[model samples]
Target: MDTGVPLSVAVSVVGKRQNPELVRVAGAGKEKCCYFFWQGRNSTVSEKGTSALMTVELDEERGAQVQVQQGKEPPCFLQCFNGGMIVHSGRREEEEENAQNEWRLYCVRGEVPVEGHLLEVACHCSSLRSRASMILLSVNRAIIYLWHGCKAQPHTRDVGRTAACRIKEQ
Candidate 1:
C-alpha cells in the first residue's frame, strides 16, 4: 500500500440491488478496512439516517498498510481500538525533519468502533526505542486527544526522555 495516503476520513458504503452496503471509517490516506455497520431490515429507510444501515460484504478490503521505517521512529501518533505493536524504524535526513514527518514502525489489531465516528492519527518519533517508549505517550496524550476532538496540543518537553540510548546499533 502507498504510504502517502491519509487514513483519517469517514466513508459510507451503499448497498446495490445485488450487493450489500457497508460503511468504512479509516485514517486519511490509508487503506480502509470494511466494518459491518448495521444489518438490513426488510425495507430500507430514507437517506437521512438510513445510510447508517447499509450492509457490507465481508470480503471487501478497505485501508492500506501504514508504512514505517526500519529502525526509525514513526512520524505520527498511531491509534486503533485493538492494541498494536512496534514493527520497525528508520531515518532519512533528506526528508522533512519535523516530528510529523519522521518515520517509525507499528502493528495494530482491533475492532474499530462504528458508533459516532472513528479516527486514526499518525505520529512521529525521533528514535526507534523512544518511539516504543512513547507508546503510552501517544495513547494517553495524543490518541485520546484526537479521538475526543480535544484541543490540547502535544508538548515538546516530552520528546527527549529516551535520548540517553545509543544512536546506532551494532
Candidate 2:
C-alpha cells in the first residue's frame, strides 16, 4: 500500500474486494468495526491510522521457519493482514528495501514446464542466466518483458505468459 494515500483510501480500495456492507459501514464511520493485528500488540482501526508496508527478512539458510516474536519498538508501520486478528503497536520488523522497487524480476525454475513456478531474482543483468527463464515487470512504463535463454528449459514461454498475467491482475 502507498503511504502517500490515506487509510480511507485503503478502506475504499478494499471495499472493491471485501463485503459491501463492511466497506460501506466503515466509510460511513457511524459504527466503525475495523480491527486487525499489528506487530505483536493490540491495535484498532480508530487509531492514528499511520502505518507502512515493510518486508520481514528471514534467514536464507533456515528457509522459512516460523518463530515466536515478542514486542519491540521503533520501526515503520504497515497494514498487515495475513490471517487472524489485527494488533497495532510501535513495533516494526526489518524492512525489505528491495520489495519497494517498482521493477521486479522473477526467474522461472523447475524442469516440468510449469506454467507459473518462479523464483524472484534481483533486477540486475548479472541475474540473467542461460539455463532458465525469466520475467521482467516495469510498472512505470506499464510493460512486461519475457526473456528465455537459448538453453533454457521447455516452460519458459508458458511460465512467463502466466506470470505476466498474474502480475497484471495484481
Candidate 3:
C-alpha cells in the first residue's frame, strides 16, 4: 500500500486531576490510503518513566479507527477496526519514579479524501497517588501525516544524432 503524502499538523495537551488523558487526531481523505508512525515518552522526578511506539493502517472509504489507552490501574487497551480490542499489562518501570510515569505511542496509516477531514485519538494515564506519588509530568510531541498523493519520477531525453556526433569526436 502507498504510504500517502505528509502534511502539517497541530498538537494540543490537556491535564486533569484524578483522571489524565491525551488525545491526537489525524487523517487523509476518503479516496486514498495513508499510514503514520507514533512515539511517546513519560518523565517524572522519581527517575521512573515509560515509552512506546505503534503503527496503524487506515481506509478512508470505510471509516476505520484505532484507539489506544495506557495506564497503571486499568492496564493498556488497543482498539482497532470494528469492535476489536487488545489488552496488555506488566510494562517494566525503568526506575522507582517510572512506576508513576505512564506513556504510550500511536501511529496510523490511511487515506482521507476530504480536505477538512479529522480523526480522534486519545490516551489516559492514571495511578493510585497513595502507592506511588505522581510527579510533575513532562509529556511532549505529536506527529501528524496528511496524504498528498504520490510523487512523480524524473523524465529522460534521447539524442537523435548520437552516432554521427560520436564518430566526429573520435
Candidate 4:
C-alpha cells in the first residue's frame, strides 16, 4: 500500500487457512477491508485493480520485519487482529537520521520470531495506545498497514491510521 496512492486498501483474512489477501475492489468511497500478519515467507498480497503482487518475508537480523521488494508499495496503515505486541523496531540501513528514526517501539526483548503472532506492530505505542484497536504499523516504500478485527477499536479515519516511524530498505 503506497501512501502515494489515495485508494483505501486493506488485507482481509477470509475463510480458513487464515491466509491474508489484499482487497482493492469495492464500492466507491468505501475503504478496503484488510488485515495481515507475517513472520516468515510465502505470504501473498495483491494491489487494487491491478495484477501486481507482493510478498512479506521475515529477516532474522531484523526482528518482526517485512521485506518489501522494489517497485512495490505496501499499505501505509496496520492493525493487530489477535493477541500480539510489537517490541523493538530495527533501524533501516538506508535511514540514518537518528532524530527522525527514534526507537519509539520497545519491550522486554529485541526480536521475538516465535511471538510474532502475539505482537501486532512495530511503531510508537503512543499512537497505538490512543485506542485499543489503534495498534498499527507505519511503512515506507513498503508500508504495511495492519488491522485487527478482535482487539482494535473502530477508527473514524478510514483504514486505521499511519505510524510515526517509516520503514526503509537499502
Candidate 5:
C-alpha cells in the first residue's frame, strides 16, 4: 500500500469476506462528508458541476487523515494509474456547495499484500473538480460503478498530487 508513488491498485471484494484482521477504519471525528467518483460506463458527472474531493472542513476540523493498521503488502509490479485532472475556474458558490453530499470515510489502503485474496481499497476522482486522480479516497454506504483493472500507467512521482490552478466547474 505504498501510495507514495507506484500506485496502480483496484482490489475488489466488498461486503462480507471480512478478513485481513477484521479491518477497521473511521477517522476524523467519524467523518461527515466526502465524495470522489470516477467509474466508467458513466451516467453523469462530467458537466464540471462538483469539486472538493477531500476536504472535511478545515477551520472546524477534518482536513485529511485516514489510518489502517496491519502491514506487509508490497511486491511492486502494479501499473494501472489513471491520474488526470485539470480543473481551474474561480472558486465560490460556498466552495463548491455541499448541503448533504454525505459519504464520510474516504481514503483507506491498509495491508495490501496481494497474492490470492484480501483487498478492498477504492477511491478515484478526477472530475469532481478535476486534478489529483491517483489516491483521492472517500466513501460511505458504498458505490463503486466499475473500474476493472489496468490502463492508467502514467507515473512521474509527485506525491499527493492535488493542484487547482484557478477553478471552474460551477
Candidate 6:
C-alpha cells in the first residue's frame, strides 16, 4: 500500500513498452511483502494495454539473485521495492510483437491489514471467496468485469464498480 520511492524497481521494459507480459524482477532472501506501484486512475494495473510498466516497492533490501517474469504469468512477488537497484524487463522485439492474451488481477481490499490483500491468489477461480470482491480485466482488453463473492458487502460492490468505471473512462 506504500507507493513511496522504491527500495528497488523494474522501471520499464529494456526495449519498449510493447509487452504486458513485460515487467517484474525479484530477488531472494528473507521473504517479505511487496506492493504493486503504478500510476493511472489508481495504482492497480487493471487497464487495457499492449505494454505496461509496473513496479513493487520492497520493504527491505535486495536478496542474492534476481529474476524477471512477464504479464499475468502469476507473479512470485506481488510488490517490488529496492532503494538501491533499478531492474529492467523486456523480450525480443518479435516476442513483444507476438504477445497477446495478457491480463491483470486486483483483489478488493478488506477493512484491515490482517485480511490479506493478495494479487496472486486472484489468479485462480478457486480462490474467489464468498467474503470478498474483485475486479477482472478480460484478456481481449474490451471488457471489465466486477466480481463479488456471495457474502461480499454491498459497499464493496459499489467500490469495485466505481474503480472499474474509472479505468474504463480513462
The superposed Cα distance between candidate 3 and the true structure at residue 162, in angstroms, equals 72
Give the alpha carbon lDDT tens digit for every residue of 93-128 in model 3: 433455454443221111211111112122333321
- 152, model 1: CA deviation in Å? 24
Once all C-alphas are superposed, what RMSD does model 5 give against the true structure? 18.6
Off by over 4 Å in 1: 1-60, 77-157, 161-170
Query: What order do candidates take by lDDT, descending?
Result: 2, 6, 4, 1, 5, 3
> What CA RMSD would candidate 3 show?
24.9
User: Candidate 6: global Cα-lDDT?
Assistant: 0.42
lDDT values for all models: 0.26, 0.44, 0.22, 0.29, 0.24, 0.42
Higher-scoring candidate on lDDT, 2 or 6: 2
Q: Which digits, one per residue and each the tens of the lDDT, describe model 1 over residues 1-170?
A: 11211233233444334323322333123333533232122212353133332222222464323332222223232232112322222223323454564333232212221111111124533322321222222322332111111221232112212111111110
Q: State which candidate has the highest TM-score.
A: 2
Off by over 4 Å in 4: 1-96, 99-127, 130-141, 148-170
Candidate 2 local accuracy as lDDT?
0.44
TM-score of each: 0.17, 0.39, 0.17, 0.18, 0.17, 0.37
Among these predicted structures, which one has the highest lDDT? Answer: 2
Cα lDDT for residue 47, model 2?
A: 27
> Given candidate 5, what's the lDDT at residue 127?
29
Which run of 10 residues does model 3 get worst, by summed lDDT?
152-161
lDDT of 4 by residue, 1-170 (tens): 12111212243433333323322333223323432223222223433212122212222222222333322323232223111223333333324653464333321111222212222335554445433433333333344444333543443122233221212221
What would the per-residue lDDT of candidate 6 be over residues 27-123, giving only the tens digit for each residue?
2222433333332222223331211222322334432223222222112233231111111122234345535635545665533222223242335
Clashes of 1: 36
**TM-score ranking from best candidate downward:** 2, 6, 4, 5, 1, 3
Candidate with better TM-score, 3 vs 4: 4
Query: In model 6, what is the error at residue 135, expressed in angstroms?
Result: 1.0
Give residue 131's lDDT in candidate 6 (0 to 100): 81
- Give the number of colliding residue pairs in candidate 6: 14
- Candidate with more favorable, higher lDDT: 2 or 5: 2
